[model samples]
Target: MKTLGQKIRERREELDLSLREFAKKLNCSPPFISDVEHGRRFPSEPMLEEMARLLKLDVAEIKRHDQRAPLDEIKRMTEQDPGYAFAFRTLVDKKLTPEQLLELVNRSKPSPKGGKK
Candidate 1:
């Protein structure tokens, strides 16, 4: 499980892009990019998308290492329906294993795309 910084730095080096060059392409400062690479900070969603495109990596791959809570989204969901809040509380109280969580998600309704469950 490589950290986002490790993945980005490795891919950037593999593509022979210098820090300044990568930053220039991303329209961000080199220092900010350095901070992200050193794990001092995480890139925003839009920035992560751009990095994924440039590095030929999936956005989800980078996002898995984000370490930031999706607090805004969670708050919105909980406000929209109390069920979401209850579900979250239950999950925290039970301290469900990651594997259990994935299994639970897998048992949910199929996607709109009609993909297999």
Candidate 2:
């Protein structure tokens, strides 16, 4: 699996940008760009957004390249539970964006532990 850095580097190359050129566009040093390409550093959210704009990347594409754990965990849960399986299927059917799902989850109140409240 390619790391986030590799993915960024690939996109940069696809745009035919040299390290110096890309760094200049991003307003960072070449070394910082190199470290980010080599996985020695994580990019900031603002940087990520700039990259997304430059690379024509959407939120889903970026998340897929950077974070797979949430999807993997859901896959595991679906395999172990029929309810989860159904819910996963429903989510796919609805084509809900990750941001929308996150909003829904954030808005929900967690149930009280042990049914005490």
Candidate 3:
């Protein structure tokens, strides 16, 4: 798996874009762009959006390369929120399919009178 910066750098290189040129498109300093491409910094949401547009790539592709929070942080969040913990535990325990998960999500939605929505 490539780092986010590596992905960004690779895309830029593929398009034959110089660092300065890419920075101009993103409205950021070249040094900042360099940092981002070297894994010393990450782009903000707006920057990521602009990068996706300029690179002609899906935003999801860029987002997919983003580093997730550490496991300890995830554990902390799960422990802090009882409802979230329960839902997550239930999901793990039941190993629900995508359709089943969708059903559970939709089940929480309010229906109009006569139980129709």
Best by lDDT: 1
Q: For candidate 1, lDDT tens digit of each residue in 1-116?
A: 67788889989999999999999999999999999999998888899999999989899887876766789999999999999999999999999997798898878868789765
Candidate order by decreasing lDDT: 1, 3, 2
Compare the candidates by TM-score and give the number of the best one. Answer: 1
TM-score of each: 0.74, 0.55, 0.63
Which model is ahead, 1 or 3, in terms of lDDT? 1
- Candidate 1 local lDDT, residue 84: 93
Tens digits of per-residue lDDT, candidate 2, 18-112, equal: 98998988999999989988877877879878877877878557656664246778778878888988887898899999789988778776667
Alpha-carbon deviation at 29 in model 2, angstroms: 0.8
Candidate 2: worst-modelled 10 consecutive residues by lDDT: 108-117
Q: Is candidate 1 or candidate 2 better by lDDT?
A: 1
Per-residue lDDT of 10-38 in model 3, one digit per residue for the tens? 99999999999999877889999999988
The TM-score-based order of candidates, best leading, equals: 1, 3, 2
Ranked by TM-score, the better of candidates 1 and 2 is 1
Name the TM-score of candidate 3: 0.63
Clash count for each candidate, listed in order shown: 0, 0, 0
